[model samples]
Target: MTGPVLYGIPNCDTVKRALAWLEDRGIEHRFHDFKKGGVPADRMDYWIAALGWEALLNRQGTTWRKLDDAVKAGVTDAASARAAMTAHVSLIRRPVVEWPSGEITVGFTHDSFKQHTREALM
Candidate 1:
């Protein structure tokens, strides 16, 4: 929001790679550690609106996989996903990045980061 904000657990491999990628490029950003602070409610709303809850939700993650079948089946929409993600921060996809230009990306890829950085600098 203020600069670029990267949100995820510090121990996640993807998060670590993303942090390294940003650092390698010297892209100044802020990291929000979900483990300690948890996801911000306001940002959750914004993320849902921007990318849809489907994009933000990580179905493949062990956290989601370990969830009860009932819980998995209950996530029918944004609100439901938000509830799950709120209760389990790990359910949200890794390294959700909020670019300064009001753009948001769920996961990191070198190409996407490159393009986003270019757009941000513009």
Candidate 2:
């Protein structure tokens, strides 16, 4: 909660890569595994408030793709999306990081990660 808290399933390729990136850079962080520990509703609420449900939702992922058309269509707004994300944790984007600066980012990108950790690196 203090430094950086990275939330994702460890086995995910993107999550694994992000973890490696953090480790290789010596960036201290706490990892919250969605598989081991279910998504925290409070934190999920915070993420929704900060980043918006659309930003956290992974509609392009296999989970979403595999969902029934009715289920997919049910996710029409924040409340619906939250329900979908909560019901199917995989629907949430990978590596939702809460940075030391209180910035929340969904997903990982090399440049974006570098930018987010610039101060910590400095």
TM-score on alpha carbons, each prediction: 0.94, 0.94
Worst 10 residues of 1 by lDDT: 1-10
**Model 1 misplaced regions, further than 4 Å:** none
- The Cα local distance difference test for each model comes to 0.91, 0.89
Predicted structure 1: lDDT: 0.91
Candidate 2 per-residue C-alpha lDDT over 1-122 given as tens digits, one digit per residue, 9 for 90 to 100: 44578999988999999999999988888999988899999999999999999999997889999999999888888899999998899999999999988888888899989998896556
Runs in model 2 lying further than 4 Å from the true structure: none
- Tell me each candidate's RMSD, in Å, in order: 1.2, 1.3
Candidate that scores best on lDDT: 1
Model 2: residue 105 alpha-carbon error in angstroms: 0.5
Please give, for residues 20-101, the per-residue lDDT of candidate 1 as tens digits. 9989989899999999998999999999998899999999989988999999999999999999999999999989998998
**Residue 115 C-alpha lDDT in model 2:** 90
Compute the lDDT for candidate 2.
0.89
